[model samples]
Target: MENILNYIEINELISTSGQPSVEQFKQIADNDFEVVINLALHNASNAIENEDKIVTDLNMAYFHIPVDFENPKASDVKLFLNTLQALGSNKVWVHCALNYRVSAFMYIYHKYVLKTPFDDIDISLFEQWSPDVTWQEIIKISYDEIKNA
Candidate 1:
C-alpha cells in the first residue's frame, strides 16, 4: 500500500493511482478494495498484462474504461460518472497510467455529481501534471454538460 505508484486516497470509498503492478493489485485487494477500475489502455506504460484476470482472481470486481490520453472525451467522463454512481459505496480503486486521467475524471465527478464547488474540490492530484489542450477541453466540456443538465 505504501509503494503504490502515485497513490492518492480519496476518502474511504475511492483511491486513485498510476498503473499498479500485479503485487500492488494484491495489496489493494488485501486492503479491502471491492472494485478495480482501470482507465489506462492495455498497452499503457507499466500496465499489467491480463490485469482484468488478475483483479478478478483477487475477488475484486474489475472495470476497464480505456481513455485516450491525447483526446479525452466527455463521453468518457459521463461513463465514469455513471459507473461510479452505480457502484455506490463500494471501495473502488481507480487508476490510469500516471493518474492524470483519473484525477481529471475525479475532479469532474466531484464538481458535478457531488455538487462540490470547484474551489472547494481538491485538485492537487489533477494539478500534479499540467493538462494540455485536449485534456483541458474535455474537462471543460464534461463540466459544462453536467452543469447544463
Candidate 2:
C-alpha cells in the first residue's frame, strides 16, 4: 500500500518496499544507474502481478533475493552483495517487502563491504519505511559476518 517511489537509504544504496511501476522503473533506468535488485520475494506473488510489466519493460538485469521472513541467512546477504558487485551498478535499488530485508542487507553491505560505522547509520531510516520487522538479530548477524569477512 506504500508508494513505490518512497525509498529508504541503506548507506549509499537505496531500497524500497514492493515493486515499482513503469514510471518508477523508468526513473531508475534513466538515472545514472546500472542495476536494480528486488528483495521483495516475501511478497513475490503480489509484486509479480503488480510490477511485472515495469520489470519486463525495463529490460535490465536484476536479482531476486529470497529472504526467510522467519530466519534469514547470511548467505542471502552475501549473494545480494555479490550480485550488485558483479553487475557493476553504481546506483542500485535494493528492495523487499516493506523494505525490512532490504534494509538489513544494506546494513550488511555498508557495515561490512563499505566499512561504514554503525553510529553513522540512522535508525530513523528503517522506522520511516514501516517495515514490520525488527532488525536487531540481522544487525548482529551482519556485524559478525563483516568482522569475520
Candidate 3:
C-alpha cells in the first residue's frame, strides 16, 4: 500500500484520500483500482489538471462529482451512490481535498447503502476527525431522506 496522503482503504471495494500526485496514481493502479472518483472541485488547490486523462491513461475510469465543501447537497450524495452502484464490483478510489468530503459521503454510503454495522465503520470514518456541524447536518439530512424514501 503506497502512501497516498491521508489514504485509508475501507475495504477491497473502496478507498478515500486527499489528492495524490500522478506518481501515486500508479500506486492506485498497481493496487488494481479500476475507478478514480474525485470529489474535489477542479479549481481545488491541489486538483491536478487533465485528471480525467491521467486516470483514464492509467486504464481506470474517472468520475468527478465536484462536491462543494461549504454547501454539500443531498443530491450529491445520491449521485455518489449511483456512480458506485453503476460500477458494480470495480474497485474505487474516492478522494477529496484532505478527505473531508470523501469521509462524510463514505460514512453515509457505508452505513446506509452497505448496511454496515455502526461500530464497524465509525472509527475509520472519524479517526482523523469528525465532520464539522455543517457536514454532520448534511449527512443526517441525506440519511433521513434515504430512510424515509
Candidate 4:
C-alpha cells in the first residue's frame, strides 16, 4: 500500500518486491517500514546505485543479500532467514530486480520460518511464471534443508 513496485504483503510485518524508485522509497518511509532488504545483484539493470544510502537516508534499516541468480545457495536462504528473524517485529520490505528472486525466497521463509498457512500465500510465481531452473533448485534445496533441520 506504499506505492512500492511489485509489492506483495506477505503479512503485516513482511513485504516483497521488485526494485523501487526513489519516490517509492519515500512512500516506504511515509508508510513506516522499519527495514529494507535487497536480494538483487549489484549490477542488476534496475539496481539502485546507492540503495543503502537512500534507505538509510529515509531512516530505515537496509540489508543486502546479493543472491546469485545463476547459482542461488541454501546458505543464502539461511542468511536471509536469520536476518529476518533478527529483525524481530520490525516491518520489512524485501526486494529483488523483478520480484522473481524475492518471491522465491519469501516462499521458503513464509512456509518454514514463519509457519504461515500455505493457503494464504499467493504463489502466482510458482503457479504462473515460475522461477528458472536455478531458482527452482534453490527453492527445493532450501525447503529440504528447513524440513530436515
Candidate 5:
C-alpha cells in the first residue's frame, strides 16, 4: 500500500493527491462515471502504463496538472482550466504531491469561476491539509497575469 496524500470528492471528479496504488485507482475508477484528474508530482509506473487504456475504457480524460501542489504556479491553474474546457471535460480529478493543490484550485474555482462566497468554503479542511504557504497571493498575482493576458 502506497502512502496517500489526499482523496476528495468534488462534483463528479475524484481528485487524488499523492501516489495511489493501482488498486486504489481501480477502486476509484469503479465508482467514477465521468473523468479522473491526476494531480500528482510523479505518477506510478502502473498508472503511466495503463492511463490511456483506462481512460479510453472508462470514457474519462486524464489531466496532468503541472505545478508543485504546495507552491503552485498561476499558469498551472490557467492551463488546468484551459485543458479541461478544451477537452469539454466537466468532471476532473486534481491531485498533486498532496491534496493541497487540488484543494486550493477548487477553492479558487468555486470563489472565482462559480462565484461562490469565501466564507462558504470549508476552510477548516483546506487549512488543515494545505501547506502553510500563502497561495492567495500567488493566486491573486496569477489572476492579474491572466487578466492581462
Candidate 6:
C-alpha cells in the first residue's frame, strides 16, 4: 500500500499525516488504525468526498475538527485532546492539509498535555516549514492555556 502523505508514526497507537485518499483509508484500516481524526475542512483540496462514511464503512471511528488554518484557537486544541481522551487506547490517525495543522496541534499536545520536554519533542514535522506569525502565536497561546489550566 502507498504511504499516506507526510505520514508520521507518532507511536504504536498515534499517527499523523496529510490527507489520505479513499484507497489509503483502507490501508489505514488494514494497519489497524481504529480512529481517524481529520483537521482539514471537508472541502479542502484533495479531501475525499464523504470521508466520514468512508471511514465508518471501514469500521473506523472518524472525528473531524476542520481547523481554520489561519486562525487556530485554543478551543480547537482542547477539543482535540478531549477527543483523544474519549477514544481511550484506540489506535488513532490524525491528519490535515500537508500535515501543518496536525503538526502544530501535536506540538501543543506533546508539550503541554504529555509534559514532553521542549528539546525532547520531535519537531521535524514543523521544522520543514516555518510557521507564520499567526500560527506561532496560537502555538504559544495554546500551550500556555493548557499549562495554566
- Per lDDT, the best of the predicted structures is 1
lDDT of 2 by residue, 1-149 (tens): 13464465543445454456667677767654446677766355546554544554676556677777667766776777777667553667766655667766767777677787888864555666544444566666645574354
lDDT per residue for candidate 1 within 54-90, as digits (tens), equals 9999999999999989877777887888899999999
What's model 1's lDDT at 27? Answer: 92
Arranged by lDDT with the best first, the candidates are 1, 6, 3, 4, 2, 5
**On a 0 to 1 TM-score scale, where does candidate 2 land against the true structure?**
0.72
RMSD of each: 2.1, 4.0, 2.1, 2.2, 4.1, 2.0
lDDT score of residue 76 within candidate 6 = 83
lDDT of 4 by residue, 2-107 (tens): 4566678888788887899888888877888999999999999999899999999999999999998888888888888889889999999999988888888888
- Cα TM-score of candidate 3: 0.90
| Residue 65 shift from truth in candidate 5, angstroms | 2.1
Candidate 4 pairs with clashing backbones: none
In order of listing, the candidates' clash counts read 0, 0, 0, 0, 3, 0
- Report lDDT (CA) for all predictions: 0.86, 0.62, 0.85, 0.84, 0.57, 0.85
Cα lDDT tens digits for candidate 3, 1-149: 54778888888888889998999998899889999999999999998999899999999999999989988878888888888879989999999888888888887888778988977884454767777888888767656675343
How do all models score by TM-score?
0.91, 0.72, 0.90, 0.90, 0.69, 0.91
Candidate 5, backbone clash total:
3
Q: Is candidate 3 or candidate 5 better by lDDT?
A: 3
Query: Can you write out model 5's per-residue Cα lDDT over 1-149, one digit (the tens) per residue?
Result: 12344555544443445545555556555665466666555443324555646665666556666566456677777776666556454555555555666677676666666667777664445657635546766544445574454
Answer with 4 or 5, whichever has the higher TM-score.
4
C-alpha lDDT (0 to 100) for residue 135 of candidate 6: 90
